[model samples]
Target chain A: MKFVLALVALVALAFVPSFAGPYPLGLGIGVLGYGVLATAWAMFSGPTRYISLATVAFFGLGAYTVAVLSETLPYPVVLFVAAVIGLVVALIVGLATLRLAGIYFVIFTFGLTELVRQLVTYYEVNVTRTLGRYVFLPLGPEHIYWQLLALLAATLGMAYWVRQSRIGLALRVIGDDPVVASHLGIRITRTKLTLFSISCVIMTLAGAIQAPRWTYIEPSIVFNPTTSFLVVIMALLGGPNRLFGPLLGAVPLFLLFEWLSANFPNHYSIILGLLFIAIVFVLPNGVLAAGESLWTRLSRREART
Target chain B: MTTISRRTVLQGMGVSALATALSGLPVLAQDRTAIRIGYAISKTGPNAAGAGISTTPNYLLWVDDVNKAGGITLSKLGVTLPIEVTEYDDRSTAEETVRAIERLATQDNVDLILPTWGTGANLASGPTFDRFGYPQLAGTAVTDMAPDLVKRWKHSFWMLGGGHDYAEALVALLVKQRDAGTINNKVAIASVADGFGIDLSKAATPAFTEAGFELVYDKTYPLGTSDFAPVISEVAGLGVDTFVAFSYPPDTFALTQQSVVANFSPKVFYLGVGTAFPIYPGIAGPNHNGVMGIGGIDPDSEALAAYFERHTALNGQAPDNWASAVTYASLEILAQAIERVGDIDREAISAEISSGEFDTIIGKVKLVDNQLRSLWTVGQWQDGKFVGLAHTERAGAREPVVPKPAWVPAA
Candidate 1:
């Protein structure tokens, strides 16, 4: 039943580009882009409880790849290159840093973003002698929307596959108790690295798909640390443990931010910060957890009646 | 999807209504009461300080002043239409900028769209603005791609001349100082490793060498370098008579304060972006007087005085001496063009701007090949006022301050 509903919703969303104009299509593009990122983010960080802030590093690599190569290479080839780059970088970084957990891991991932940004900036300033590159691609808003929608579908499929597979069971055990998981003969590091690499590649693809919309690319714009923070926030607020939790969090929050930024530009940041604090306090385990508790209580009351 | 379909239906109705009104424009001239203008700019983010100081204030001031004077008179309609503005804060990100611009154009259906602040945002939205036939009078963007951009986007206009233009103009002034024997040909140059800084420093090095000046010291510091004492000391030790730094705001303030602390006063001291900011004088104190930077305005111009007074009165702070006036002048050009066309015909307005000359606070302004060629490239702080030191048109520039006055330590 849930799978059927999910399929229905996906089909409905797929039809948005057919009816919606530029403005709604623009918002849809943002929603779907963030959806893919948050979903992929949760795929790794959800069960393992490892907060990785290197989403933008991969995202930026993807974007910079497209910006540099899109004009000379075919779009599909550029995207594939972006994904390959993201995969290799993530594998190397995950292998090196997956041992460190908790705050240490968080700080490393955060630093990783800055490291990539600075490296790209240095290369641009020294090698290219140019900072910003103009991305004159044939892709328009509809093209971006369709591509992101398709990416979101692929991300969901992979995420669901991970959730249902033995890898998912091993990941859950690893999250529950790593020592116990080791006793159970699960290769913890391999499981974590594989998932992390996949998640990073999804983020990279999302960034590549959205780059043409920007029409210009620079280190600061693509490698903005805010992207990482927003992804984490959206994933957390939606109950990252569930398959659809990140999307649940992303859609409303993206719309709410749009409304807030539109209505109160001066105080939107303050309001957004307040809302985040409120969400953390009120929905500590996320909306899905809260909803599950409500369902349990209602079922108990119905049984009593 | 349901909500989207409903909104699309409403939009369709709105479009039909607009079409009907356009079809009966002779009868609906009186009904066209307001000219709706919209813009999305950085109001609360990394670019807020720049947008607030150089761009936003001018936009607000121009809109207010135009409405106060009974709005723009439409000679064809024989009626004056007040300007109505819808603003969005872009949060200084490309995604938000693109979305907000699209919303302004398609959702709000604004009659005209004003430019956002910065080179990237303007360039990011250039294709959109061109597709919608909106004239993009970019006041703050400085790029060598103006000629190419103008050709690609017909309605796009560049106000700030390229970095090469700025370098050549400053080098011209230095050549004059060299000819007068007020300073030696020895020069030191440093630049922040960012787009604006790199472009200027790259251009200046070649221009200075071409103009026969000895390049004594050259270096580049990263974007957010807080400590500049070492660089200042190194350059000071080099005994270079002229010190130029292509820097951003924080760096400009830091370099000036640090230079004062180190007593590294050169015969010709120059900085970049933040030198002409209203806050620079307060930060640099007495040391700001002889400091030259990227842009300048005619401090003695009567039009500038009025603009400054009005801007300060409206915003409770003085506009920057450099881009603020130019930004306001761009709006003035837009308003004049709209009035000249006597209607909200975007194509006509764009053509009017391309061809017409208008009196601006910066003086009579015209776009040659959709680029404003005549502009102040070098400015110096003189007697608490940032004054134009050199111009591309070779007119209205004040005499260069020879052997810059010693930096007075703040009491």
Candidate 2:
């Protein structure tokens, strides 16, 4: 029944391009792009409680791939290559850094992102001799929206499948206590690596899909560390434990940012920073957990009456 | 239990409704009497410094002046329309820049749109402006790709010439100095490892080599490097008579300060980007004199003096001596083109801009191939003012001071 409902929702979302004009479609593209990223992020970080900040590393790699190959190859082929490159890089990075836990993992991932950005910058300066590249693909905003919608659906489906599967059980165990999971014969490294690779591939695809929206890209623009931070914040704020937490968190937060930025161009950053502080203090467990608690109190009062 | 929460649904609905109302308001307003001009600029992030100094101030001054003069004339409509401005801060990101531009076009239904801050944002937004049929007179964007980009986006015009233009002009000036026996041919070059610096250095290296100047030391430091002591000491030790740094503002300030401390005074010292800024004299004091850089302005132009006075009065800061006047000039061209067309028809405005020449603060302006051919590529500090030293067309250029005076700290 739930699967059917989600399928219905996905199909409904796919029709948004038909009614919406370019403005709304552009906002939708932003929402869907972050939706996939936050969802994919939760799929790995929520289960293991390892905060990975390398999202932009894979995302930028994907964008750069599409930029370098979009002129030479078909759109679909370039997207596939972007995903493949993302997966390979994720596997290597995951193997190297997944052994560390807690803040160590977070710091390492952040370092990895900066490292990759520097490498790309170096290559562009010393090799290509141009710091910025122009991407002239035949993709419109509608095309981007549809593709991101599809990617978001796939990400949600995969998150759900991982939650129900044996790997999900093992991940939960590992999150609870890693030593017990290892004693339970869970291949901790392998399970973590596989999930991380899958999540990173989705991030890469999201980047590749959205690259054409920014017709010109450079290392600093695409590999911005702000992207990784936003994904983390959205997932955590939505209650990463829930399957739809990131989406619930992403939609409203993305809209809020769009609104704040539009309404208060000069002071939006200050307002946004205050809002993030409020979210951390007021809804530490995320909006989903807060809602669940509110529902529990209401129902209990109803039963007493 | 369903994963969709009641609160999420309520918030989403509220946002959707608000978005609908916002987009629908412009259509419902029956009186569309004003010419709505929109732009997305970097008001808050890393790019804000440049936008604040060079781009945004000119825009604010131009709009205020135009409105004070009873707005733009539309001869075809037999009426002059007051301008209504809609601006968004792009937060110095390309994604936000593109989205804001799209919103200006489709949502606010703005008649004219100005270009955004830097090379990347302006280039990123080309296809969007083309799609929406708005003319983009990019003021601050300088790239070797301008000729091709102009062809690609017909409505777009580049004010600042390519990196090669600046490099060629500076090299020609240096060759002239060398011929006068004022300086030797040894040059030390350092550039910031980014688009602006890389482009300038790449152009300058070849130009210098072609002019038979030997490169003594050439290297690039990362973007955010604060410590220039090592780089400055290394270059200072090389005993090069000519030292050129294609650096950004932060690096430029830092390099100048450290060079003063290290006493690395080359006879011919040139820094990029910020050297021609109004603030350079204030920051560098006596050291600013005879220091040449990327852009020059004709200090003798009476129109330019008035522009500077008005800009300083309104913005509480003098505009950068380089791109600020050109930016204001681009607006002059836009206004003239609009008056010529006598309507808000973007196609007509773009055509008029492409074909017509106009008098501006920068003097008789014309774009040969959708680019402003009249540009100052080199300027130097003389008698406490950053003034134009060379032009692309070899006209209206002042004679450069040779063998810059020894560094002296301000009392």
Q: DockQ for all models, in order?
A: 0.30, 0.50
- Per-candidate Cα RMSD to the true structure, in Å, reads 5.5, 2.6
* Model 2: residues with Cα > 4 Å off, grouped in runs: B1-26, B409-411
Interface RMSD of 1: 9.0
Per-residue C-alpha lDDT of model 1 across residues B1-411, encoded as one tens digit per residue: 533443453354346445433422232233477888899989877888899899999999998999999999888878898899999999998888888887777766788988888888888888888877889999999988899999989999999988899888889999989999988989999998887877888789899999999999877788889999889988988878899999999999999998888888899999999999999989988778888998888877899999999999999999997888889999999999988999888999999999999888888988899999888889988888888988888674578787889999756
TM per candidate: 0.93, 0.96
lDDT of each: 0.87, 0.89
Task: Provide a comma-separated list of chain B TM-scores, one per candidate.
Answer: 0.91, 0.95
Q: Model 1, stretches more than 4 Å misplaced?
A: A1-12, B1-31
Q: How close to the true structure is residue B274 of candidate 2, measured as C-alpha lDDT?
A: 91
DockQ of 1: 0.30
Q: Which 10-residue window in model 2 chain A sums to the lowest lDDT?
A: A275-284
